[model samples]
Target: MRTEKEYVQWLMSVPRVGYLRCRKLLEQFGSAEAVWEAPAQELLQVPSVTRNVAEEILVSRQSYSFQEQADFLKRTGIRVLHKKDPEYPLFLLQIHDPPHILYVKGEFTLLDDKAIGVVGTRTPTNYGVLVTKNLCTELASAGVTIVSGLARGIDAIAHEAALQAGGTTIAVLAGGVENIYPPQNSSLARRICKQGLLISEFPPLASAHPGMFPVRNRIISGLSRAILVVEAARKSGSLITADQALEQCRDVFAVPGPITSPLSQGTNDLIREGAKIITGVADIWEEYPDWQANYSHKMKDEAFQLNPEERQLLETIGYGGVHLDHLIRVSQLSQGEVYRLLLEMELKGLVKQLPGQMYMRSSV
Candidate 1:
């Protein structure tokens, strides 16, 4: 195999071959060495490749220069990861499309941590600020490394919360590892590199651009086990990450807010569509059960499990509440069977009987 540095340079040499296109190139070409030796006509024939790409390949092959870029990266302390590198993120590869290369500055192995993406509006409401901080802090304290865009507002809050909890935070940039957008967040960027990871698909000299953000959003969700939307507007880019997470089969959680707040629209819609309604870190508990051993809040409590009858009873209630008669109707069980299960659930502290005998989840 060509070393990762050679692979990275070979990819960067291809014109218009950003992370996605380069990923496709590797999938088809097998290795950077083989790709480098391929005919320019064959390079031009690559799906979605342009004629300029073929020309760039022909030229970079004749004049390959690696020392300057390496020295520049070395000066900045940014490490480049090629698609074949073991340090390349494993979860990202599970996505339908993933970056072929990444420029990471900081502890590279933070990518190995069990991670969750926390995203929301760059311009957030007060409620967004509150819950973003709360969820990130709680999740980080529970041992999850928080991941998010390093934009303003909610993203910044998520990273700050992770740091506050002494947990790792990964900032996925739309620009390069050396480029900090929003200009004002340079300090926040520094802190993230010091305590966690700052990653970008773009190379070191790449600059910030609005068009790059949607692609960045994909990487944010791609590297995560689940994505938590703390606050988002109807058209928030955070919603894009939520959609990508769903496509990747990662669980998505959204924090709700006041109906009047614009930031709540996207989250409320996610809830209506059956995304997990996360009120606290415990909502994510079942997904990370082993992590509970480290938290005092969790270690202090005993967990409840369901017996066959209880499972049947819970399913009878379905996604919403159900009356005793309806539970009997859906379960096709006799009134005696329904009553016995409901009473058992109440005794086990799993359900509560309403005024008219409807049953729903217990607040406990």
Candidate 2:
């Protein structure tokens, strides 16, 4: 067997055979080598095969030797992963646009782990840097792998924090496996290769370009269970990733900030639309009870599960601890119903009633 990786390299050499086209052909033909060996007339029989694409596959098959391609890959450090490989990301395979092959560099195990994407503006404010570090550190300690683009600001801070906390992270780049954009993160990229994973969908030696980023966002969300936007302007590229994550049916979380901060606009808007409002580590920890199983004593040490009506009352408090009157207005469950739910949830460790009867999400 020419192994799927070798076959994918052959398929990639064929001009105009993009991710989707390659996937479709493989599903129809059964294998990349099968498609390559199929006569041009036979190849065109598969759906969506362009007249030019079919011809290019024929020409390239005869001229491009597998050994030459292997040599090229070695020189550029691009290791290809085919769908059949055990190393392929399990979550990515579930997505509609799964890459036929991922051109990866650095450690591959990070792809197989449970990861959460931490994204935000490229030029982060001081607050963005602090939040990015704190949350990633918390998440990492709780046994979640961090995922992010290797761009500047918040992304860099998130990656660094994961490493600093003695945890692994993954950087899904918009360029080739050998390329790191924003240029300045070269040292950080090197550290990630040593401790985490750095990957891309493009071939080795391919330069990073503007349009490739939107395509790159899918991989970020595709690799994560949820995405946490640390800070974004109204028009940040992080918003693009958030939208893609929603379409991919992943949870979206945003930290609330002061209204006076311009960088808070996107996050505040996300909260208004009912995205999960995140304040501290517990808000995220409770959302994934599976983590509780392995969570250090600090996380599982004090936790409780709430019933439906009680859970509704707890949500009324929101992330930042809403006051009693405001929480009642927002919940709309009436005082009697609210009081009962609150009492049950508070005893269950889901919420705490402050001095003024305001409720807050419990940390313990």
The candidate maximizing TM-score is 1
* Alpha-carbon runs more than 4 Å astray in model 2: 13-17, 20-30, 38-59, 72-78, 293-363
Prediction RMSDs, each to the true structure: 10.5, 9.4
Candidate 1 on 1-364: residue-level lDDT in tens? 4475665666764557776667666777877666777897777767877788777777777776567677788899998886668888888888877776788999899887889999988888765776677667766776789999999999999999888877899999988878788678889889998899999988766777888899999889888989999888897888988998999999999877779888799999999998998766656765677765666524212222456666777867754678888777777888987776675455333566667887886543
List where candidate 1 sits over 4 angstroms from the true fold: 1-5, 13-15, 61-64, 297-364
RMSD of candidate 1 to the truth, in angstroms, is 10.5
Measured by lDDT, the strongest candidate is: 2
Q: What is the C-alpha lDDT of each candidate?
A: 0.78, 0.79
Cα displacement (Å) at residue 295, model 1: 1.4
Model 2, residue 115: C-alpha shift (Å): 1.5
Q: C-alpha displacement of 37 in model 1, angstroms?
A: 3.2
Write down the TM-score for model 2: 0.74
